[model samples]
Target: MHPTIAAAEGLVIDWTQMPTYNTIMSVAAGAGLLTVVWLARALQLGKPARLEGYAVAFGVLGTILTLTGAHMTLTWPLAKYFPFDNIIFGEPSLGFGVLLLGSAVLLWRRRELPETEDRARELAAVIAPLNIIIVGLGLALGAIAFAGLIFQLFAAPPEEPISGAFAQWPWVEATFMSGMFGVTGIGAVLFPLALRGYRAGAPRTAWQWIVGICIGLPGLGFFLFGALNFFTHVGLIINTMGS
Candidate 1:
């Protein structure tokens, strides 16, 4: 067993409320993904008219993620079973949430722009200077993803009861979660390049495609996983009650 779970062996938890965390984080991830998709489409079509809507959506999602992530990071609420989860899930969410919120403000301020193409250029220009920070975040995420993958493969292996129905297919659960991290890492690493390409009027560029796929896939996965957990958690509650 993982050390954290081992440490938390005797503690009783209310599984019913656990899904709330999953739901909130997943919604934030999904909304952010949708925002990115919309922004990409707008940029591709050179339409800035709808940028304000995207900005509003991003701001809301970002706020939700930021608050939740901050609380998780500071409190380490899951320390009992998965302490590292605080770092793996919380830190990235916080960082990315702040980025989204900031970007929303920037986009909102420039909503009067006539062309999405120009907006992209301006955004790219603003972010270009932060390449170092972006790269650092990418590296951190990559390291976290790699570590999480290793832990999932060799440590507890997700066979614990917390895995619920997935307890039988530990490797699948491991791969799915780790894969989400890996893709999100890749997206962060390639984000600057993708933005630069988009700004240069190359919406169809490879970097852009790769980044979009990486980010969008994880977004969908988080959303689906969270949604699935809601039902699974209810089943768990029923089973516990029946027993």
Candidate 2:
């Protein structure tokens, strides 16, 4: 056994027995997919009522993800993995959840005003100022995704006991996860264009389609994976961390 893994034997938290990790991932997945759909609707139809519905959805999912992610990030429940899992999963989940929650609040506030009827325009205007920050975050996510890919592929192959049942598939698990991260990174990088197109009232813009696909695919994957983990993670935790 690796010295790290050996040291972590009895100390590692068993995520399978608890719903915390699964719940967080599931909420993140829901929020991600909802954001993509909301953006699509905002870009295409720009319907006020529909957009407001999405805001409510975001508020619910975002609150769940934000609370769970913040707890995981702050408390570091999975202590064996320490900062790696915290950085790769906890921090991003917290950040995106907060973003979603904030957007929901902003949209909800706009809806309360009698004069602010054009939600699409309001959305575009609200996000435009943050384009630079969004782009920077995109770049950072891309960098982290790239580093994760390399680490998964070379530094920590699935054959390592750490992978548990994933080792049975060799590099397949790593590839799928890395691919998800890659597409999500691409979506983030191109999201500014979608915002720009919305601001310009161009519904059929290429950026919308591209970003939608990029974000939607991973959102689905994460949702399904999180659901699956509800059943499979017990074996994984035991196999990798030992009983």
Best by lDDT: 1
Per-residue C-alpha lDDT of model 2 across residues 120-226, encoded as one tens digit per residue: 66667786776676566567667767766676532322323433445555355667766776777788788888776464244467887788888887888878766
Give per-model TM-scores.
0.81, 0.76
The Cα local distance difference test for each model comes to 0.67, 0.62
Q: lDDT, candidate 1, residue 22?
A: 48
Instruction: Tell me the spans in candidate 2 whose CA falls farther than 4 Å from its real position.
Output: 1-23, 46-48, 112-117, 153-169, 199-201, 237-243
Location of the lowest summed lDDT over 10 successive residues in candidate 2: 1-10
For model 1, how does the per-residue alpha-carbon lDDT over 97-119 read when each residue is reduced to its tens digit?
88789878977887787762466
Q: Each candidate: RMSD to true structure?
A: 4.2, 4.8
Worst 10 residues of 1 by lDDT: 1-10
- Model 2: how large is the Cα RMSD against the reference? 4.8
Q: What is the lDDT of residue 200 in candidate 2?
A: 25
